[model samples]
Target: MSANGLVQIEGLTPPGNAHRKTSKVMLLFPPEWVPTAPYLALPSLTAVLRQAGHEVVQKDINIEMYDLFFSDTFLFWISGRLDLQRRLLEERERRAALTDQETDQLALLREKCTVEVFDLAERAAEAKRIVRSQDFYDADKLEWALNIFREVMQYISAAYYPASLVFYPMESNLGYRPGVSREVFACLEDEQVNVYRDVCRQLVLPVVNREQPHVVGVSIGTQMQLLAGLTFCKMIKQAFPHIHVTVGGNVVTRLQEEWPTHPQFFNEIFDTAILYEGEHALLWLLEALAGGRPISSVPNLMYRGTVGVETNKEIYTEKTTALPLPDFDGLPLDQYFVPERILPYLATRGCYWGRCTFCDHGQGYFDQYRGVPAHQVIEQVLALRDKYHCRHFLFSDESYPPALFKKVSQLLVERNAGIKWTTLIRFEETLQDQELWYLAAKSGCCTLYYGMESANERVLNLMDKHAKKSVMRTNLMQASQAGIWNHVMAFYGFPGETRDEAEDTRRFILEHQPYIHSVELFYFVAYRHTPIVRSPEKFGITIHKQPEYDLPLDYYYTLNEPGGLSCLEAMEMAEQFYQQDFHPWAVRVNAREHVFLYISKFGTNRLPQIYAKPEDRLRGTDSVSGLVTWPVALGEGDGNKEDGPTMTRVVSHASGG
Candidate 1:
């Protein structure tokens, strides 16, 4: 409404014929891990665009991306190649069993293999090397693995769906491993180039010909994701000249600081580079395209031309609260393959405690916390419940601030808007109020995902987590007492972590098994933008003398502690611990019940029964709360105090009878 002539929403629309718009926009989510659902970015962006009257279609390319590479055809090809290699090995073994002349003949036969077969053989050899070596998993070597994966994907794409809209999924620094330095990570440019070419030939060309979307937008969340996005954009431009392309998201917000001098950074593949939050920028770009206005003149857009890329001086308002809750109704919700279709909601942007050293969000743009109003949040919850039957909502806030949680909890209780939810919370903040935990439970809060990063005090200090082991333990116990399940996430293999320290963490988990519902263990990988990655020497750790683009696996280094596990070993141990203690089935059960219990309580017309027994009511409890307090019987003094001793106990309580 200010500059681009786009209409902004003021009040609610009465149920009637809303005028339909003609502009078509396709939004793409690149591939990522199967279990971890893609962040719900496009729905919010689409809602904004739709409010401004644009027909938007979203595609989650993750399933397709996985399918393209892991299909039966691709598997069969790999299997056949493996068989050929096996046969060659067997022939050599047979030759070893025979005369030297026979062995020489067999070697000659192997040398006479075709180019394609030889390439397959080489790939098999490399795969064997990858399986055996510790260095293969490093952050710097991730690109090498990705390149290998890309080739398989490319081969499959050529054989199958040629001309699909290929969106490269975002990659974060978490996937990086040890041994690989940043410099080695950067050297995999050629592999990325090949990936781009394959994407163009196999996907972009066909989609452009078929659907002819007016504009294609690529989202970049991390630096690695940005590289993939840039690659896709260049391919899109070269293959399909008629369509407009745009780039936005977390990476775009910091692009100016990272690469300010690159010409066509705003141009070439991208007609417009959206800055800040993209909802407004997207609408402006579309209007410019449809109305035939100069692309360079669009607000919140940076463009390129004869002189250079011109950035408008217009400062976009960060305080716009008129935005709609993400329209998931339009998205392919069922297409999302997860144990539960997690409804991700952002109550606020930025962190309440922005003092954490390792936080990129604290240092990045939108550093201040801006929360959506309570009424607005309730409205969105109602819409999700009524329309999509969504009962489980995950707060995607950096930290679900205590004040906001209290308000939301109270509102949910008052309105009787029953919904089970989980959020990341500070240990001390939640522990300070028992009422908060009780209210959270009454309002159907089932789980609290806590980032109890380490058991070691030094490691915690280095990370600036501002938490103590005792505080985390107490909060976890209180949460269990409040009937709220606790999911403890721990980071092992931090820079200064010793074997004894790792064992102590393991021992701690064993000691507090009853209070904690599940534990997820992760190996620490230094992110490029983080303080630890920047100043490794401060913590007596070595930063890899490599480029920022390199993956973690390439720069492997050892800990100073005697008999201490390397980063790779520590990561594997943590993964094993997670598998043993917090299996996938447990997570699924928690996630599933998180929604089902809430919906059962709210959707049907019966008042939810809070207590599990009649005696609970007799105990003068208003309603039976299913608070899961750990019996003090399992603690240090009350139990057989020997370490590493396993015992099973069956206890009967009279209160719940």
Candidate 2:
């Protein structure tokens, strides 16, 4: 039976003799998946397999590609190309001729060549210097490191693909939408423009084919990874032909829900696609595959069947707290693009307040909120600390549960678990407690990112964000005062939101600039099946020309009213906001440099006097090393003149840099 008929059982095809159980599995995180650290899925899955006693190997191809692409050897090769082009251009001019197009091209190259050549050489020099320098992680040197990295990546991209090839937050120009299926397919087969494909061919396929793992898993955690993820999967399937391939992550989970129409497109790339909390689901499927058993027993999976395509019962009720700690064993800890190793750990799963209208917490992507016990979480932390000598951690949760965080902080106090971390947090009433704020800071919560989608009360209500603008303001202030770096996330273009809300948000950021160290502004993209999309009328909006999708893609949105802030307008506002110096503390919404920035400044739970002047702000410095001295104010160090936290400059022989 096809899409029109009753589902039959014939389509199910198990891996043939070519995919015989080798008991070895390889998990890959493709290029542009992430820049700084590896996404959590690969490690989580790898850890599960390792615990289950399966031979597993995992590698972050993004970081490997980063190392190779940014090497001096690569830069020299590019320099050679530029030099050859110069010679060829002169020789051609002397040899009597140039076509109009060739003349235009030569002129453009000549105009840009000197600057490009010099810039590339300078970027190379800076990179070589910073990588070898002792103060590599210092703010200034790190910025130098990032600049050179950006240049090298740009060089690669301009030469082939037009992708940004960023690391801090994975970004790319490759198509990720449902309509781009054919484009993605072409990209996979194209060797000329597909840089990510080239990356997989050089770094991915060889290692994968060498290991010849029976199962290959790819994690498409974000839209940024979608295209490359699909491309990588295509390469694997084409090369091996019989290796079982599966994909899971937020993107896959959401797509499976909205377009349950088992996109045979997905079938072409993946044998099975796992959704939701995948620990048990993935493990069960692997167990079945290895044992040569029928896969119907596995839950939360979609597999193509002979009769038709089908999905198994969802992994709806797994208690995440009961799951084992995520293992980061097989990852390359040293090669990440960051100066300090920032490992990811999740204390909880899903958003506690699942009512945000634009958010899809209810959509199978998010779990019904739950948290692991503080002690169990700490045990894992200690183990990871031992295994990977890194103190920085990023809590990869939708919203870091305030209660769980406080509990974890108290435990960190009782037992000295010295790890500094940052995470996305909700600004709710619970944060009114000053003690909670203090405890969070003392427990090494370096930054708390607040989702202040809008600062206008009406916009907040419209989005069903639950928290008010006042609450957001107060929470930010308290968090900042508590010695935590408050990072704000703002998005405009909520259906009913207009200039009023946009200005209100801008005003709030300006008013509380000291409290906010960064702002991640986004122009809202209405996704399918979310509350906004399900009932556009409720928000007085009319979605126009919405095409029925065989695969999941979020578009088909229009404002009911005339000439309002469309996505483009909102984008313009965000660009203006970023370009202008709207506040005293530099609002960095572009890169993940703030992680190292904060580490280089505040080493512990100490109060550095908040500087009101932008000039006093520190960017990169070598002096921060000495600031890692004794405890700031130990326990109950709130406001006592003697024992309380006191403001002081880093007070070191910090150079101007």
Candidate 3:
């Protein structure tokens, strides 16, 4: 304790003392940069490069440009464009209108439009301040910020393609749908209304020019990031033709798997494209690039050759323990829309249950099952917590393994990691055990996103989720009762799924509203290399020739038995279920996991009443509550000490925890 009863808190400092280093490189997560947390790929890559004695810089343009986007300056440009268009429309209508009613309506329209534009501008300014300020986690203030984004996006969506401030990588003709390279170039050529293109010019170019990095690596994880990533590469290559550009991530790996089938578009955009785990491959590539060795020697990479695309076989590493700790040294971690920063840690690589028919997660990122030992994960978690002054963490794994997760949970209870965390989990026998769920909560497990693809057992089997409806429902309640935020990711429109089966999903949610905190439901799309597409006849569907898209697409057409909910029907059902009924609290699922964590920490939950203090919680089978067993000596005081393993700091509950 301080002699004066005042706590001394050290500020966050970057790891490297050197202001800048030669052999410079820059890694970026392109727009729309998620404002929730820093992307995991860049930091992991940064750590590897820094360990290799290369000075690597990291940037999340998603966040940087977002600060710029939500200002009066951006709004001013948008509002001016909106006003000009609307006034021109009004003039066109007035030229033909002579009636008093028409005149009144047009006059009223002008009045309303003026009021709305000014109101929208004010809202944008207000949101910019709150988000850029310290009070970002306040739901009310956050809502205002959201409103500003939504309004600005609405205008942009009208002028450009339909854009969104909600889900990231907002819909563009350039992204999501599959096409060849020429189409991609056409979209990039459009400078007037390409939102992501503008992001590249304004935000990315200047930074690249200043740094003049030797290599510029861009991370494209989701289908959404496809266009922006491609655009990012194009801009870098055009601006600094000498700078080597590499594109990689889950999305890149998947696209590379289908390389032979697709036209030769990738070679034009990036110097090299990395597939699957790029750790060893990238390290070798960088070494070779710097050493003037044969670039063809780099495995897991497709490089442009003098004659054709030169492909290399990827070297696989089953043991994940050898990788360096992910470094978040260069990001503005505090600026994410949360009171406390949420650090993303990868405890494992790939899924243990690699049998899911609908999922391609196992195809590359989680190709073979591997995980760091539980003790090591906890050790790293503790180290990261201490270093960053962050207690909340998000595990960026395909699904945390049952055995590993349980072991970590128990260790967390013992060590009191003093950390709240969330992860994607498959509903299995291990999780069904209520005791393990309780242990998870005590270890500070705040949210678990279960892939409840369907509540209908038949559809579940068809999708190869392999989870029984009854069992999953029971496990959900147990986890919920244990005081963990049990969120779900559900989907409809599997090959043989009927509307009735899809409705059963809704029935499950309604039946377990108390236990289930949130859900993300949608129609399932067939990605290339998924089981259903690989063996369409096995699922009683005919694979149709799909149109080539500018961006590599995840979905293709299927001539299936007409019993399932069509994609459009599924969208309608989601609108009815989430928007009409659930509204603000129960909303559409975005990539933001921090929102769930914020809700758990800052918002209300039933845990405090249900969970007993550690002491009262029984060590064995007794009438009590704890993670697994409430130790007899563990009272509120002891429980408090055991639960908070990290350094102590003063926390104010004035915001209503």
Candidate 4:
């Protein structure tokens, strides 16, 4: 509405028959998710919808967007686009002295225009080939291939000037605050920086026109995906008014309370939002849309009622045992950015030990815990393996329980499923048995990611982790001895953790460097749904609320008495740790998937070839301070892992898929 004549998206419901029968459904996984593998949400929801006799076409636009970024056609198109921008910027400059922002934009456009598109495109294609072939095992080739992706991403980012787009970690910023609803609406229609608008026009709308589906569902799993996912929804609603657009995912569930306040979201963006555990909820919502049942009867749904937007009172949780196996029929499984097909199979919903005070992962679930039996899990894993012709699996469970872990390991050994897999688990006192680690390794368990949040017992108790140092050390030693790659996740700050306690964690990782294969360190964030935020006094912190961030899932805060490390100190300590203490964990391969493949191929965690060269390590030591810092790529080490079954939500565990 500001410069372009796009209508202000408010109070304008598309002319769709909301209660029309829905038969065919097109589900979309939007951009900014890790492109290494297909997110489990689409397949999970597709299985449920198809089981109900509905025609479903699941599309992973995230991977498609990445795949498009490195293509000759797209790169050439980008070059032309940059040239056009250059001409327009020059025209503006001729009229008057260019503003600072405009000058910078023009410079970026000019720089991008000079790139040899043909050469770049050829190298880009080769890079993709290297990653998907036997050449992927060569460490140098793989590193070059990954760097090529980052280079392409840089070029693409320049084309969309002012928006900082990135390839890995899915941390692309569109220069808009997604937590601010008004900015979100503006970002949806902005043609200048909103690359997603172009993405939708080129990739999404054409499919909608061809498929002519009755419903289009977009899964938004993380805060990083919010802008892109909502852009798809609003665009789909605008282009095909007859197709009801819906959204569901971990992010949606987290923002459920914030959504109803903005009724325009329901009126213009999406017709409905299905909250936590969407398998059965989505199926029933489709039935309601088809007029087979009352709209009010649909559970875990937020819809536009006569009064305004209304959330259904009922909550529905799927019975893990009765659900159909995830259907990956419509997904482009081979197109993932990996040499081998890695399928994510979730055996559990929600964390079994759901006691982390600073974690809000439990809020994404209607039920605290629900897991399929060990035999059932084995059957499903084997079934998925055979059906997909895949030997690698990611058990995307939230903190795999000790009992289930042991039983599954034993079963995998018994059946000799011959599948290499990994998952997230705790340092359980019950799992200290050496035989368990041996059995797990024999069953093709290549790596295990642990949430070793702290090394000091006091801090652990405060975080409700309750993990003992002795138990953690024993587990790591046993896992390493059994040839399992051990990746530990720790944070710098809890509410009252002092510098000494944070040092205890750093010292622990340093002392146990041989046992720990990788480490991900992060500063703490007080999420909106965590117990600390609900009762700030209990954690001795003051929550600072910003009026502009209407849809915030996390908050800024200050310690009440300032005895412990302040937030700024926490940030500095984390940075210092990464800069000074990064040498031991800073390997040539940083991505968890890449590390896992190495472990599986080499049959040991002692991967000397993956380490940085001696010169590189020495260079790190000679940096601005004590050592050189390695550029870490966050594949599965983001430190904010989500529960597996919450529809494509990713967590910080080392299981990338």
Top model number, TM-score? 4
lDDT of 2 by residue, 206-267 (tens): 99889988888887654556777888888888888889998876667767754345364556
How does each model score on lDDT?
0.52, 0.61, 0.62, 0.80
| Alpha-carbon TM-score of each model against the true structure | 0.63, 0.80, 0.79, 0.92
The residue ranges of model 2 lying beyond 4 angstroms of the native Cα positions read 1-22, 76-134, 161-169, 174-179, 257-268, 314-317, 361-367, 545-552, 561-568, 581-590, 593-597, 604-657
lDDT of 3 by residue, 128-244 (tens): 666546555555565446555655665454434223333232333433233465555666666544677778877898999999889988877655566688888888888898999
Model 4 steric clash pairs: 620-627, 620-628, 621-627, 621-628, 641-651, 641-652, 642-650, 642-651
Model 2: weakest 10-residue lDDT segment is 636-645
RMSD of each: 14.6, 9.7, 13.1, 7.2
The TM-score obtained by model 3 is 0.79
Regions of model 3 farther than 4 Å from truth: 1-22, 76-122, 129-137, 155-180, 257-268, 550-552, 556-594, 600-657
Candidate 1 residue-wise lDDT, 76-170, digit = tens:
55345434644765676866664564455345334433226445445633543442244333323322433454354344332222212221222
Residue 357, candidate 4: C-alpha displacement in angstroms: 0.4
- Per-residue accuracy of model 4 over 1-657 as CA lDDT, tens digit each: 324332222211123534435489999988877667777888888997887678998999988998888899999999888899899889999998789999999998888888988999999999999878878889888768877887888898898889988755456788998889999989998998999898898889999999999889998887777889999999999998889999998889988999989998998999999988787777777777777777887778899999999988777766778889999997888888788888888888777777788877766676547788999999999999999999888777768889988999999999989999988888989988999899999999998888887899999899887889999999999999999988887777888999999999999999999999877776777788888899999999999999999999789999998679888887788778877777766666545666778888889999888766667776764311112342222222111233221111123422211
**What's the CA error at residue 440 for candidate 3, in Å?**
1.4
In lDDT terms, which candidate is top? 4
How many Å off is the CA of 38 in candidate 2?
2.5
Local error of candidate 4 at residue 393 (angstroms): 0.6
Whichever of 1 and 2 has more TM-score, that candidate is: 2
